[model samples]
Target: MTTTKPRPTGSSGSADDADATYEHHLTADEQKWIDKKKYAWIFSIVPAAIPLIIWGVAEWMKAIDAPVFFAHASWFLGPIAVFILIPIGDFVLGRDGENAPEEFVPQLEETKYYRIVSYLYFPVMLASLILCCWQWKYGGMEWYDKLGLAWSMGMTSGIGIVAAHELGHKKTGFERWLAKIVLAVPAYGHFYVEHNKGHHVKVATPEDPVSSRMGENAYTYLLRSIPRQIPRAWNVEKTRLARSKKGQFNLDNDVWNAWLITIVLWVALVIGFGIGILPYMVIQAVIGIALLEFVNYLEHYGLLRQKLEDGRYERCSPEHSWNSDNLTTNIFLYQLQRHSDHHANPTRRYQSLRSDVFAPELPAGYATMIAAAAMPPVWFAIMDRRLMQYYNYDIERANLHPSKAAKLRKKWNRVAAKQQQTVKAG
Candidate 1:
């Protein structure tokens, strides 16, 4: 059921309008895509905005002389809102599968308004981080309160990585640089390099650190991803610098230069806010980057690209990535769940990224999937069968965890044999 939206303002014509060469009236579904993403992009800031919400709630609780748990729980609200509430919204609101009409796509891509919406993330994120640092040290809050705040701030930076991911994909220098800067807060500056240079190229292959294999838990993937990503990122930049006759240690290297930003920011925060904030910084960074990698783990979990006759992996297609239509998560992650389209047209802005029906689908949005990924048994129960179904129950087609491969093959063999026998008995 496609609801007809008013065509985006400032448009000369829309799909709703009848044109000279057109044969018939356009249905509401076929109309020019309304720029719902215009305002939805702002929702990504909710994690960063957690402190403001906390302040308002805290003041109200003080006025009412509410229990101490109110203050503690207020800080905890960030996690609840992000993981619990937002996912609820995803289910209730249903899917956002809209795409800009072919005729409208060029104009949609050219629109600068869309670009500006994403750029707003930086200041809001910076303010949230600094304010949280001050409050953690001097706000007269309990130790538990500080931990909640730090974790909440970690969620902010964690989600901010998604913002950086959006900006990083743009061809412009300023946006790319901003991506590096945003990542500095989480000490994941290497993501900008490795993601663009390394992961995208080898995505859904046996080799990609960012892509999770069948039967691999998110914890194992994170353990593998966090350490490997740095050297991977460094190696990418090192090769680039070598081509230009530059030293790896110099500011010209994107890897080191980005790390320099992290070092400077951390040192300044430590000096300004006292060394107690150091542990908070670590707490936040770990949580933040862990959240980022968790997204990575689920995005292409158990999907694989078949190798071609030449022994090169086939070009990545919509089939290689998992896609979701969970509306709230889509808006929160800047349509990242419509990942197949982004990979198909890497430079396409989020506003213009289309949803492909052919892509592999996730059973639910990020929050649900992230939770499942944490517990390997639950994840395997839900995803492994679905993955095998996607490949016609063929284990050979999967990018599998080395340790789990033999067991998985034997298990599936039995399942297939039983199914065949059942058919014969019938």
Candidate 2:
């Protein structure tokens, strides 16, 4: 691993200061952990295990004609495990101690763990899809139950959403192909085109559907994002074809062709499972989209980049994204909360990602944030003040835009107005 010396935290001369602060380099023990590929494989298992086990147990319950309560309750367990328990474990149990040993930072260029994690994508996804098919076959679940499971299980973790995130950053043909396959499972294949081609380039700006604006609630964002993203994906693919002088129907390399493949898979599922299963498929897609939006809410909750004098947004840095060091959650989601580093270097594998202790931390893990987002006043109250403090530092070293500064002031004003209105009503 290439160890780039740590850069300073401030806007001006902090890079030099940051390098000076660190005297000791990586110890022998730290090097061993950094060098191994097995750690990635082991961590991948943490997220996949619970869902797979739930599917197996539910299947068994069906075989035995188990009581309805046991079988029905078991269905919700997998979603709870992924969204609730794992996030809580991450926030409460994963800690960086004061006495933790210093380690040499791994080289960012190495792709060791990235390769292994990418390969596991297919098997884990196939397993989840098979489980969904099984549930359709014998569980005799209603449309809503199957839909909920498909959305929460097959789409959220099965391969559609998470693996798409992994493949969206990769450059190789096989890596891109794998990403498309995962999207097919959720019938969200357009994400491969829009997310990779559009969102990354336009993130945090008005042009990106997935990027939430300041003061936008998650529910409001869902209303806009889902409808916007689908057509955006198609337009992006068409633009790419026009630029390359390729015919619109070019199947060999066109992203629309990939979407066609996803449609075929969707049709096959409907035909085999009866057209009644279509609603379940739609519900699962909705769930997957909900999970994705929730993740968007956390990625840059109250953050925005400044426009420079050159009429361009400042280049994204570690400071541009939120960071969380909750180890269990990091392990479970494949280091997703170590988001600052990922944005700084998009293609870096999760195993090699590091936490910037100087970066702002999320109050809780992603799951906690999801629950908190449901209550807007409470969530805004907790986060708004912290956002002000983050940007209100010494003028020579502040990391915020003028618009954001104005937004913060306006947010406080709105809070005061609401309080005054409450007092009058009371």
Candidate 3:
């Protein structure tokens, strides 16, 4: 319900001023809807900022001769915030149902302020990573503190990837390259190619390894998704190169080149710090990539796009993607919780992404759901029932694990049939 004046199109320093022209056409009510989440998007930087704040606290604690345990505990505030505090914020702040109408998208998209908010994350995140590395090498910190720092960096890098996701989806070459650059922090630069080329195209279908299968646990998912995504991304670039008769051995291959950035970054950090810094880097990369996968797993779990008579999978609709509108997660993630609209318009700016209330909605925002996904029994206990209801107990419609398909189909199809019979009798 909060409101602000409708910013003149291109007034916020958008580069393409000619396209938008210096004008405002929206009525007062429409302007209010557009501005509701405008400032909220700035919170996307909080994840990237957490490490720097933690570093400052640790430094302050040291200066004060604070208890060693208190100093060490500060390192864990990053994970505590991501996994614990953010979820609580979702419950407390509740859902955001605003969807700026289609007429407003062009002006909303041209608002450069939103992009600038995301643009801040990279430098802040890199500074945080560098500081964390320095502490690991030169601060004489204990092993537990280093371990905590690694997880903290991982959590930040994981959120950095979310910013990268926003950047990667833009039509501009600059944003795309920024996505690759940010992804290098977690050694996950391949995500740039695979996510845009592979996952988006194959999402919610059986062929997509990145899209979690109905019965797959997060632990097993790491084995399935990680091994497959790298090669798939490579192949996508390779196929593109092949069309022009260029081989993948050269730097023209995006996957190899992007990874080279990762190699150079890690090597530079190792050379500057000690070789001992390598293990913490590895730890952060593992946890960072795991965090990214956890989000991927829940985004499209159990949703299957039906195949047409022509044998092509039906186009991905809102029905195929899970949506959540918890205000806290929405703001921190650039409204990524409004995922159905994202899949529909992949290159749409985050501030303009719409909510589809009728789409299959996650029971809670991704912050809470990802924690549930980490525990298989908990994930299934929460999501399976909702997924069944989405498909109206027709397990045949779900994107199920091959191993569990028969058993699930037998049980759920019977329930569906019983419901049909009861409806007929009524």
Candidate 4:
């Protein structure tokens, strides 16, 4: 058997040699090159805030009675640009595919800039929601325009989940509180409870509602995940409270705190904007939550960790989730597509998460894939084949939903027969 080599401590080796020995994967030269790069680009990620600005612009354009194209089209800007243009841009601009050097890793992780960005998202998200409400209550517009305002605002609200996701993973009191504040916008505070304690524990298995199985369409998955998530979150929080000897409805139950926040916000908005604002609030919450679940579907579609004889599943690895390193998309999403690394090390800060070469790659950014998932046929055509490839064409190895297994088996047989015919003809 091969023995593992000892890693050098900072003192044991020459400066160059120490750098080489420290990283498990990178070469000495690669380490040196990456360490020399400046951390300034981390600040450039601020431009990812543009969608919030665009939402404001969309509302302002309508308020001013701008040209029909400018006014009507403004609502579509966030969705179209994020889903369509950014994916095309990823194709054209391509990926850098660089992971920071181990020597510089500590520096990157220790920086306050990353935390500041997460904090900053809270205000921007709050501002977007306020703007939407103000326009709905005061600004005169058609019902369709109001709907457009909700839809545009909903896109940003969905992104608040991202902020909440990052902050939810933190252990600090302030970060956790910040997560609840952002989550209240979409009325999805339960995610903070479920995602951390529930999804992370059962991801990639049939037990996980958040993890989509083969042949389950996005709509079906959303229908399942959204309802299941709340109960799962409640159970998780209930269990925690029991272990700690705390009451479930008490402030110690973080879910209860977040739920209270959500309810208060909803009541305040309803009181201020009248019963008419109720539908807008509901619609935006549904859209935001649906967008999040759709993302959950894309992240771990058809992947599974094998259950052991003892009943525990195999430890999560990089291969369990799909990854993408599209430069612009990664920046926009706060490197969330470095999902493999995130699952493998849940507490790692988003800025410090690295792309693992072994993880299965997504063909496009999550935004683009989510757009495609809206059409069942297009989603199946793209993802089914990738699922097949991931499992080496073995249907049995894929985590297929029970109801859809027979249908998937028939489809697999047809594809196999077609391939056989091609071979025989050749």
Candidate 5:
């Protein structure tokens, strides 16, 4: 809804130059808007409290010792809420296509309300995680139920990391340290190192492991991305310390600090709650990291930036990311689905992120799509067609793994042949 002219190809000039030129083209008249909407921004903080809500319900269920239905399935209450209810709610409530007026963008971005919510996100998340750990040790649930509870805790905590992401992009040291603190919840401190330093530079290209290429399934992508990213983060941090003439082992190494914090958290939980808490913590952490990976898979799956004549990939643009403006999901996820804008202006606050019409649209909210991604056939059937259509059936335009290139080409040819045959029959 924030209408702007199409940007020139990334190869035409530097990315900063493109952004500056784009800003310069806007006229004074188009920048003014009388209406200011601040009430809706409050809903963005709801995700920070989801863990507490889930914990409250779980406690209630235990108090009642509810029937088998609630007792057995209560552990999965968070996932069911997010993946099932949220998607359904999105479809029912529908999307808001309005973008904040241009002049109002700065005012929204500068709000202390947004910053305060982000800052408080950490303590709430930390409290919920401790509560979950306590419940796991003493709740006397079956292994199945315990696993479910741990997973729910993990999933909700993973959303907390989304708050961490918003803070991590800030230029201030306080926000960045908060990012590192929140990341320790999932033992994913490396995310701070890799995502900003590594993924941003190479995203939507084959060089980035986090970016799922055409024909790659989510399962395969998860396995590849999670392992590779840790070392990638470490290496990135190592390089940074070297440039600063600092030792890799020092506090200046953020990766080391995050890892130390993670180790301390785990050790404290184990000492406080006994060895049983260890599995719960580890499983929950794994699930939390997996949730992040699942999102990474969906955000840029099968999209690619073009290579220039000099072999450097074109700078990323809105077209390189799949976006959803689905209102309910966007509110819960902190406008993460407006990912095109986030990548284009990495430091922009979530409340001010605009939906770009030029970005490729997702069929549904991320929660619905994440569920679909679990079924590889369904994911392929939906996304593969979208990918082919986006590239006009030209495989060269797609970022495909070499092993799948020939098979995808053959598949494309078959689709083309079917279309031709249908035309002849007509």
Candidate 6:
């Protein structure tokens, strides 16, 4: 079991109080390490290395008339490497101030290494797409192999999701454009507009479909979020165009064009590779979408802000978002586990993201959480209690009600019933 040491609460004279309670219950040394920019280089290396190796293997496989298994697998590797592995690795491997005697709070403001790492995302995405096409043409990969390729592409697109998330927070036009381009890779360009314009503005409130209400299961969230997000994306773009006095057909702001690009790309693949490639692409897309939803589930799982008497939700703070300080997963996924910081200060670079020791820590990294989400009863039994403890067992304050609780109970029971039925059938 992962143990997070609690820090002292309250403000101090220091810029970042090592003694202050963090959302994740980090120690003083962990706080100091997070404040420093020393590990930025490490982020750059892993993302770059994974794609370089994948592309090289893909080319070699093509030459040898072998199936591009690893190349296809590389797609999933990138997301797993970035989102699941990195943060978890960091939490487990990172040195706390207590363990490392040399640790000190650095005076440095930012690291150039982080900026370089941010730039690496573009090339990595491009290389993954190119390798997918190469494998399709030369390697003559089979259907299963193509499915792997699709999954890899989906994984590559998941990185694009990370990039979209990062750039969406920036104020500059260049940063925003980079973010849109990243979103385009996933054919999720609308996410750039919707997430910034809609989700963030309406987050943790009923208006935001992506925000999971207390007692909602992952399966329910997937059903609701996916369909809602697509229309929300369209509505957001339509609203933007309306404000600018432009029509939906206007190429400059048309979301349909972005989606068209995705369709055209798939059509080209089908034409070049045959009808089988279409299923491959669709499956790849599903994997990417699944990854996105899973992250969404992680972001605000079982957390809700209280509605004030004035009919407004409380201001989002570090406590509103779930945080994971796992060292490996943090570095790989670009500090996404430092979610509370991201919600509190959206524009801050991933390198500068800080964890709140006071916030609840996920029982495991996202990979494990995804698996756990599959078993609703077990997931609810485990996470429900943890959430209750985090919020001091006040279900009402956490926006949990008897009806929602009952629904969760029924969902879990159904899951058990189905499993029992499966066992009997087997």
**lDDT (Cα, 0-100) at 353 in candidate 4:** 80
- Candidate 2's C-alpha lDDT? 0.64
10 residues in a row with least lDDT, candidate 3: 6-15
Candidate 2 backbone collisions, by pair: 1-107, 2-107, 8-14, 8-15, 26-104, 151-284
Best model number under lDDT: 3
Using lDDT as the measure, name the better of candidate 5 and candidate 6. Answer: 5
- Cα TM-score per model: 0.91, 0.80, 0.91, 0.86, 0.89, 0.74
Candidate 2 lDDT by residue in tens digits, 1-426 = 334345635323343454464445655665565443335346665444444667677779889999977877776676777667777777677653211222323343454655666567667766665567667666678765665566556434542466567766778888778777777766677777777777777665655667665566778877877788878877777677878897766774446767887898778877776776676667666666677678876677656656779989756656656767776666666677877777766776666566776567777777777777778777767666665456542222233233455665556666656766888999
Q: What are the clashing pairs of model 5? A: none
The per-model lDDT (C-alpha) reads 0.83, 0.64, 0.86, 0.77, 0.81, 0.64
RMSD values, in order shown: 6.7, 6.0, 7.1, 6.2, 3.7, 8.8
Q: On residues 347-408, what C-alpha lDDT tens digit does candidate 5 reach at each position?
A: 99888888887788889999888888988899999998987777656667778866788998
| Model 1 spans with C-alpha error above 4 angstroms | 1-32, 420-426
Clashes of each: 0, 6, 0, 0, 0, 29
Q: What C-alpha lDDT does candidate 1 achieve relative to the native structure?
A: 0.83
Worst 10 residues of 5 by lDDT: 5-14
Estimate, for each residue in 1-426, the C-alpha lDDT of model 1 and write its tens digit. Answer: 233332221112333332224334456766734766677776766666776677678779889999977767888777787789889999999888777765577887788877877887788888888888888788888888888888888888888898899999889999999998899999988888899889999999988989999888888888887788889989988889899898888798888988999899999999999998999889888988888888899899888888888999976777888889888998888888988888877888887887877688899998789888878899989999888878767788888999989999999878777877988999
Two-way TM-score contest, 4 vs 6, winner: 4
Q: What TM-score quantifies how close candidate 6 is to the native fold?
A: 0.74
Best-to-worst ranking by lDDT:
3, 1, 5, 4, 2, 6
Q: How far does residue 25 in candidate 5 sit from its true spot (Å)? A: 11
RMSD of 3: 7.1
Could you give candidate 6's per-residue lDDT for residues 1-426 as a string of tens digits?
123443422111232443454344446655555344365445544443454565566667668777555555543455555456654665567632122211221222244555666767876776666567666567666665556566657766775677667877878776676676666656676777677777777776666788776777788889978788878878877788899898876776636766665676667666776774556556656776787787887677767766779999866655567777666556556777778767766777766666666567777666567667767777777787777667544554454433587665565456556766888999
